[model samples]
Target: MNIIDNFDTLHRAATRKAMQRLIPLMCAIYFMSFLDRTNVALAKAQLAIDVGISAAAYGLGSGIFFIGYALLEVPSNLAAHRIGPRRWIARIAVTWGILSTAMMLVQGEWSFYVLRVLLGIAEAGLFPALMYMVTLWFAPNDKPVVVGWIYIAPALALMLGSPLGGALMQMNGLGGLHGWQWMFMIEGIPSVLVGILLFFKMPERPRDARWLSAEEAQALESRAAADAQGHPELTSSDWMAALKRPTTVLMGLIYFLNQVAFVGLYFFAPSMIQQMHVKSPLLVGVLAASVGLGFLLGVLILPRIHRRYGNDCAFLGMLTVGLIAGACAFIATSSPAARMVLLAVTAFFAGGVLPSYWAIAMKRLHGIQAAAGLAFINTIGLIGGFVGPYLFGLAETVTGRSDSGFYIILVASLLGLLLVPLFAKAIRRETEASSPLGNGSAAGMQS
Candidate 1:
């Protein structure tokens, strides 16, 4: 019993050490990625004046990044599996950073679209690669919380990036560059530097981490192996089968709808706030940061809820509440302050969904399938990243009302809410089938 106790202590120590060493670095890297992705929103009005980009064109340019992203995601994940995440992620960050910085050179719509797509290509596979790394380094029980931490990067990016982007935008006419140009240049440079940091700092796997003692490393590896036991590594032949699984497909669809609401808000919230007659760029950014703060609160609050209610309960509950908040944004259209408040409320609950969704999705995936399946789901869902912005743009341009686009958010949220029951049922079934006692006995026990 003492020996067992000692082992448990060592395991906990290793997990703690790994989290301390890794999570911050990973979050920093992802924070840069998301900041670069969405900072375009802050630059939209300037782009229209300086670059002749229309609302529709801006939407397409903002979202077309995902087109390049989706195309390369699977290939990139497979390559990461082969070459190691440390190197692959560094390559992605450097290339995307270079491209993000180059946004300063946009001469017209074509250049804008091309640069955004290239940036997407450069950043492709990053999220799934990070998710794959989590599977390699952490045990099943620790994954949801770990993923929750990783998801915080985007919220932080928005929370901090909005204000930072605003401040940078104030750099207009400094050194003969527009404020947006300055924003891109300053923001993009750090990612390249961070990429360099990652190449040197990131370990390929838990067993390779020099910070961990040999016994601790062994404990981590043993825990990971045990976690992977039931879900065997998929061979190439089984790759398509794994991707085609009903649960995977359903989760992808759910994420797609969620992204429709989430990404739309990410790309347009600044403009939406601008429509509220608040003319100052910095003020718009500061107000926009409120949404990020709401999201940050949600991400921070979810793990406690998860601990108390379990995964399914936490996931469905947050998603349902989030969707409701999102739908209510439509009703707040008459009041700018109310609209902003609803947007933040929507973000707060929406923030919880990503971590919770992945927490459940990760359980059904292991080994090579974890990489492939994650990329596949992300690829499908990211297409909505494109759809959301494009449709919102189209809606706004056609109707000439900024808030009119909330109709899309309303419909998407309702559709997402309707699908939650189906997703919950599927997850329960998968969990039952995978348990030690098998599906029949698990069902019997539940009954």
Candidate 2:
């Protein structure tokens, strides 16, 4: 018993050490990715005025990033699985950074579209690759909290990015460039530097981590191997099977609708705030930063709710509440102050859903299925990232009102709410079939 207790102590120590060392770096990497990806949303008005781009055109260009992203996501993750996430993720960061920086040279709509697509292609697998790394370094029980930490990057980006993006936009006349141009160049540079840092700092697996002692590394690896047991690693021949699993498809659809609502609100929120007659660019950014606060609070606080209620119940509850609140916020009031408060409320619940959702997802997938399957799900869902912004843009163009796109948000949220039960049922069916005793509470599936 003492021997077992000693090993358990060592295991906990190792996991704590890994989280401390790895989560910050991972967060920094994703922070830069999301900042660069969404900073274009802040640039829309000025970019349109300067380049003669219409609202519909800007929306299409903004969303076209995800088309290229979806196309390469699975393949990029497969390559990361083959080559080690360290190398692949660094390569993705550097290339996408360069492309993101090149946005400074956008002379017209076509150039904007092309660069956004190329940037998407470059950044394709970073998210899932990092998720795959989680499987390698941590046990099943550690994932939800760890994933929560990793996801904080985007919220931090949005929070900080708003002020930073606003300030950069204030640099309009500094070097014969527009404020938006300056914003892109300045924001894109850090990703390249971070990529270089990742190449030197990131380890391929627990055994490869120098910070961990031999016994600790062994403990981690053993835990990981145990997690991977019973679950087969994905291979080329069966990759399609993993991708097409009922659970996989349903979760993908849920994520699809979620992104539709999320990206629609995200891409347009600043403009909506602007339409409220707050004229200053910086103030718009400051107000938009409130959404980030809501998201940050959600990511931090809501997962604890999941731990209390369990994954399925927590996920459904958060999504249902978030979607309904978000829809009502849009429909209930046109008052700027009230609307901003509601927007943040909507963001709060919306942000809570992701960490819980991914936690549930990672539990169901293991090994390369965790890598490729996560990528496939993300790929399928990211198409909505495209659809959301484009449709929102089209709506705005037709009605000449920025808030005209709220209908899309309403429909998408309702559909997502309806799909929750189907997803829960699919997860249970898969879990039951995969368990040896025809019961789903297998050791491998335990949270």
Candidate 3:
């Protein structure tokens, strides 16, 4: 075969082998993680009756997790960097699983809020640490798709989790537990089991991947080495130096905007659907889960769009889709079935933003520096998660309309759309600097 054909073959073989070993388990873990977090949305009605959680209190309890998540995020990621994924990931999953199960015992607002916070603290590092871990296992160009594959977790969580939570709620009074109680109790078990598996089976790096053949392992290592040479700043082991980079701060802000737009819609989805005259919790959960359909399309479509349009154009497309769709969803009347479809379209773009931006950022960041940078971004960005749900809830409370929150989501999406160009420019400059043709160094770029 010619060189181009030969390279394609090798790339395909390596990707297939590595992903076989990685995606299923990673997706499963992420699935469990997202499921535990978002199931609260599904359990909202039942929990309201059981614990007397008002809309405001429920919003607080849901949003408070991110407060703890944001606070501990950097520390947890750094610890993961220091301690390795096997131990740290296992600890995180198990602890969060325990806390999630304990959510069954919540008697009032304070208990609910406290458990949510503890759950956040427990789950803080999983996203960024996993992002860093992807750097170890995949090439820079491959990270986005890898990250996209893992995002199926959220899609699956919403799709399966909503209905599952609803079904579990139907089990109220079985074994002397409310259905909401049963929902938390049963769903939390898989995480604990997944944590045990991670301890035994998780590989810290490609070098530790026993599943790969020797040739595959060497190819992975060489790809990483080449990436290290291309972006020396990213290869730095100093977490502090990574923190000092202005790109880190910029990416954090970008992540924050994306989270604000997306999580606002996500956390409030079931209620949003319910307001459309869907009374069955099970049916509302199912329709709410349709956001997963949008999410699935986003993840699958982004890589192809990026390859064709380049990062800047691709980001614009993603955000523009969000802007238009979110605006339409905002103006949509509650009774139309079309409202749900528009909301899904909004979700499509909102869901794509994380993988889209992370992919852009990962092209510049790698190694432990990638971990720390991702942590910094995710830490600050998660504050948006807290803000999105809480503020969305507050808006709904004040307006006495569940649909009023769509305007908040639309505003957040608009801000992200306007500012993403700046983010894209920063990335462009960095990519150009990192290019062989350009005078490449991030020295002056530091704020």
Pick the TM-score winner: 2
CA lDDT, candidate 1, residue 224: 66
**Clash counts for all predictions:** 0, 0, 0
User: Which tens-of-lDDT digit does each residue in 145-230 have in candidate 1?
Assistant: 89889988999999889989998999999999999999999999999999999999999988789899999998887776544334
Looking at model 1, the pairs that clash are none
TM-score of each: 0.94, 0.95, 0.92
Question: Worst 10-residue stretch by lDDT in candidate 2?
Answer: 225-234
Position 335, candidate 1: lDDT = 72
lDDT of 3 by residue, 1-447 (tens): 897677566656876788887788788788899999988898777778877898888888888899999998888888987889768888989999999999899999999999999999999999888887777777766777888888878987877888888888788899898888998999998899998897888788776787776666767766754453364434444767767766677777767866776787788888888777789877887788778777877777865565445444345545666555765655765546777777777777778656766766666566677778788888889998988888878988898777777777777767766665566556557656656778644432321
Predicted structure 1: clash tally: 0
Q: After superposition, how far is residue 314 of candidate 3 from its true place, in Å?
A: 4.8
- Extract clashing residue pairs from model 2: none
lDDT by residue for model 2 over 362-420, one digit each (tens)? 77677778778889888987898999999999999999987877788878878888887
Looking at model 1, residue 183 earns an lDDT score of: 96
Please give the CA lDDT of all the candidate structures: 0.83, 0.84, 0.77
